[model samples]
Every structure is written in structure tokens, then in C-alpha cells.
Target: MTDTERLRRWRLVLGGDDDGTGATLTGDDARMDAALYKLYGSRPGGRGGRRGAGLGDSAPSVARWLGDVRTYFPTPVVRVMQRDAIERLDLTRLLLEPEMLDAVEPDVHLVGTLLSLHRLLPDRARESARAVVARVVADLERRLAQRTRSALGGALDRTARTPRPRRPAEIDWGATIRANLRHYLPEHNTVIPERLVAYGRRQQAIKRDVILAVDQSGSMAASLVYASVFGAVLASLRSLRTSLVVFDTSVVDLTPDLHDPVELLFGARLGGGTDINRAVAYCASLVDRPDDTILVLVSDLYEGGVRDELLQRIARLTASGVTVIALLALSDEGTPAYDTENAAALAALGVPAFACTPDRFPDLMAAAIEHRDLTPFTNHNT
Candidate 1:
């Protein structure tokens, strides 16, 4: 906008009073800068000259810093700074304490950190931690459950549709009338139906199978968190037989815990070596019908086990009519770090590989069910 405005923005980004922008900050701006400086320290120049910043070893200091950051910044910015404090400042161990857990903001990333440290968490803080995790899960489900069900349910019904009806109850009247609209007899002012389209009653019958093969390595924490919640939502739908298989060199079927995402998250043991081939083969064994199954592999494609066998298994899966999609990530954090070579290998075998956001996942599943080209979703994110 203006030179003054530009310099002022640069001052914030650079961090520190004498940041060489020739701009001065005071009052709220000054306090906001101090809160940032406490977490990020002073960058003085630009990138490399970063000085360390810490809120000290005590809970009071971290709590006060959290309050100041919340007062100065919005929710999203505050969450990011909190995560940076945990990672950059080594404040993760402090999170295991009850006071520290209560004084922080709750979000998806925080849940990932919590779940990763579940085994080491102090007993006193376990309840508080569960509350925080449950709150975020409930909020996500409230926003996502309806949309996921609507999209997948509609697609399932569409896929199950038949061209001929065996009885009057099975006839899709709307589709039938539209199909014969041009054959209307003007004398009788009505159309004679020659063909029938079934409305796909479904009832309690399983329409399709969906298997989520998730990687639970340390770097894939956030992806697994979102995937678990989505798996719970998908398992809730009656017309689909959904199974969730999580792996980190070994596989664990947490589908039983999918009824409660919070428990499912706790059941996941994060931060381990990855074995993509082993996991895929295990999930493959679970598949009963390849043509009617949608297998989503959520990982960054960093293979720690037989990479060649993984590619071969993927080729076989795609050849047998399984709709295979590779999600490098499933979070709001754009531009995830992934193995480009492995991604390219999967692409060569007719698999659509890319990171997908939670908001876009429902539509992605619907498109997979319809066997529609998923390039638009891939292109939009990639």
C-alpha cells in the first residue's frame, strides 16, 4: 500500500526493535513483538542470524507467554506459534504436565503431539489431555460428518443403480419418466414407459468396501490424526463396509476403535519405522472384492520396506479394478515434505498421488466411487 505500511510489516516479520527497517513499534505492537520474540527470538537480519528464545522451565512462564500470544494474535497464528514453541524451543516434555496442557490452545496439530506422547504422559494430565483431544474431534466431526455422508451415500446409491426394475417398488419413477419423455403420446397426454431404472433400495446391504491404509510414522502424525477422524465418519455409514488399517513397520486394525475417534487416536502408536510394502500387502489381504473397493493409502511415500514389491502390489491392485489413491498428506499445512521419486513411481502405475485436505476429501471419495477422473482435485492441490 504505502512505504510506511510496507516497512511496518517487514519489521514484524524480521522481529526485533533495531531490525533495520527504520520503523518503530509501540504499545500493542511492541507487546506483540515481545511475545513473538519470546518464542522465536530475534532474527536481527533475516534468515540465519536467529537468536534463541525461551519462556524458561517453569509452567508460569509458558502460561503467561501463551496468554500474551493469545491476546495479540488470532487463533490460527496463535496455534502455529504454540507448535513452534513446542518444536523449536523443546517444550514438548512440558506438555506432559497438567498445568502446561491446560494453558494451551487445542487444535489438530496439538492433538497429534499429544497422541504421540500418550504413553509418556503423566497420569494426572491424562484426563485433561483426553478432554482437549475430544473437543477437537467433536468439532471436526460436527463440521465434516454430514458432508462426508451426503457425498459418499449419494455416490454409493448411484453406483448401485440398475437399468431394469424387477418390480414396481424398484422402479426409479423420476429416471423412468425422464427416459421416456420424448415418447409421449399427445392423444393420451402421457408417456409409455419402455425401459426401467432401479432406484437402488440398498436397505441393510453393503454397497461398497473402503479400506484406509494409513502410515503412522513420526513425520506422518498430523496426517494420521485427520485420517483417524475421517475413518470414524466413514465407518458410521451403514451402506459401506469401511476398514482402517494403520501401520508403522507393522499393521494394527483400529477399526474397532473407530466408533470413538479419541480412542482410535490414542490406540495409534506414532513415531516408528515405515514399511509400505508390508502394510499394503496386509491391507490387500483384507480386500474381498477389488472391483468394488476404494483403497486409500495415506502416506508420504517414503518406503522403508521393499520398495519394488510395493510398486508391484500397487500395479496389481490397479490392474484388478481397485480404485487406489495416494494421499501424501491430509492436513491444512500446504506443501508437505514427501518423496518425489516414490510419488512418480505410483503415478506411472495409474494411481493418482497427491496431498488432500480434509474439506476436499468427501468429494474425492465421491468421485472415486463414480470412477470419474480425479485430476482436478490433484491439480488443485499439487
Candidate 2:
């Protein structure tokens, strides 16, 4: 394909807008360039030239297009499409082959590529094809961790200087009065202590516990991705303790791999019959203080387990002081066809069944940390 043909195809893909003079792609050209930059910026030669097919006359550009094809095309044709695109560019940069490797490693390399393809993905593909996001985040986590300690060390220092509140103490006033007797002036007046203040602030150590119970049934892929990311974040916090449990028929504690989110996600069984009740019971047992622990159940509420037992377990967890959050999902799409009847039943038990969005999760964690009531998201019963 000539550069002009490539430019024409790209224009068609981006929904070309007609400029009166027709000298340039304009409007949509700018938009497509921005999108292309986002997909290719990590590579060299990603910057410059918002117009012209020659803008993409580079090895990295062809590599990125190959990456895009691998992400957008079905499993069968991805490799063929990538090879053809690489041949068309005929560039010898390392990115060409790396891009092919990036495409073929379905579970590892497709995440960032898919994230770039988000705008183009259809509904069915959006849910089904996003399983690779966990792998991407795992890769990202490794890269971030390398420089994180040095970058965050100063921030940690600022936090360490903050004053903490003191707790009420049981005390004897006699010793307090004796210590203050010198100020009382023994010659003229005797002073009684109005109230006793502790010599120093005694701050109680607060330990936060987060229990993430993820439902790993086939369609709940997005929820699994979000759960893995959040579990890793909670694990990194100094004050919080996080346990990540993924389940379908049985619960497996992936907490030990929290430091490596990808490992935790890979350790999970992604598709199977869901026994939500069994998972909840297992999660309840793993937590020490029900009140101090935040139990986040991410599922569609589809169950192979007994419904009555599941509701009872949720109730028990809440009544025991565990801040139970029954999330039908943790995705950009709030909730999809969930079990409404089961959701309502759990809500009645004070379980707060609601759909949680990924962006609102940090606030949810804050509420959990403070042991405060979480303002539930849209309630889609069922």
C-alpha cells in the first residue's frame, strides 16, 4: 500500500470530515493524530506531524498499527494481520518484532493495546476481551515499583509528621496532683485538680483490613481486573492489610501474591460455576475483626450455591461488624443483568448491595478506613 492509500484508509477509519478546500484531513485528522499519539507515545518517533500518511512512515508507527490490529481483530486473524502490516512498513526497527510479540502474547501485551482500543470495542468484545488488562497492570506495577520508593519517600516523610489524636485513659489523679503540688504554693492555698490531662498523647494504632472477594465467573472479567488493581493498592498501604480471594466453585486466597497483582489474578480461576455463599463464608473467616474489616464482594450475584445460605452469610458478616459492600460489579458499566431478587434480599439484610464504579473506589476505601458508612452507588436490584 502506498502512503496515500494508507492515509486514505486511516481517514476512513477515523470517520473523515470534509474540509471545504480539501487540502488536508483536518478536524478528524487532528483527533486521529491525538489517538494515534496516545497509542504510540511510549515509542520513539511518536511525536510530531498531525497530518499526512508520511507521519506514520516510521517503523514504530507500523508496529503500533500492528498492535492495534492484534487487539481489535479476532484471535484467528491477528497474527496474519500483524505480519502483513509489518511487511507493508518494511521498517527494521526493533519495535516491529516487539509489536508482533506484543500481539501474540494475548494475556500479557494486549492490555495497554486494548485500553487504546476502548473507544472502538463493541459491547460483547468489551466484556469478553478485556481479560488481558490484569497482565498489563502487572507489567505496569513492576515498572512503577522500580522508581516508586524513591519517588514516594518524601511524601511518606510529610505524612509521618502529622499529629495523631490521643485516646482516653484510666488514671489515678493522686500522682497528677503530687506532680503539680509545687505550683500550688503550699504556704497560702491548696488547689484541687479540675481535670487530669495525660503527660503525653497516647495515640492508638489503627490497623485497617480489606477483604476483596472476587467472582471469577466467565462474564465478570472487568470486575476481576478492577479487583486485582485495588487489591494491589491496598496491599501497598502501610496502615491497611489486604486479602484477595477469587472464587467460582471454591475460594482460593490469593493474598500472598498481592504485591504482584498479575500473579494474584493469574492464580484466580477465571471461569466456572459460582458458589457465592461458600466464598462469602470463607472471606468472613479470613477476617479477624468484622468491624475493622471491609468485605467487598464483587460479583454478578449469579450463584450455583444456595441462595438462602448466601443471604444468611452476607447478613452474618454485616451483623458481626464487618462493613459489607455487595458490589454487583466494579466496572465502567455499573451493573449488567444481575440477579435483582438476590440483590434486594441482601440489601434488606443491611448488606448495601449496589453497583460500584472503578473511579469511586478510592473514596469507598477511605470510608472503609474510617469505619464510616459508604454512600452506595446506583442500586440495581437483581
Q: TM-score of model 1 relative to the true fold?
A: 0.90
Candidate 2, poorest ten consecutive residues by summed lDDT? 156-165
Tens digits of lDDT, candidate 1, 1-382: 9999899889888874467898998999889878877777733543335665568898778988999999999999999899989987788999888888888999998998998899999899899899989999999999999999999888887777788767788887888889989889999999998877776764678877899999999888888988988999999988888899999989999989989999999999998899999999988898888988999999998999999999999999989989999999988888899999999999889898999999999999999988899999989989
Positional deviation of residue 356's Cα in model 2 after best superposition, in angstroms: 1.7
Over 4 Å off, model 2:
1-101, 104-135, 138-206, 376-382
* Candidate 1, residue 82: how far the Cα is off, in Å: 0.9
Taking the tens digit of each residue's C-alpha lDDT, what string does model 2 give over 1-382? 9877676656534433341223345565555444444443334433332333332654455546655544555655654444333344443232323333333434322332343344455555444334455546765456444344333332233233322214434333454566567568567688555445342212224365789999988677767867787788767866567789989998899989988775565566666699999998898788787767888899889889998988887777788888888888877653476888887887788777777766666655665565556544433223
lDDT (Cα atoms) of all candidates against the true structure = 0.88, 0.61
* Highest TM-score scorer: 1
Worst window of 10 by summed lDDT in candidate 1: 42-51
Cα RMSD for candidates in order: 2.7, 12.4
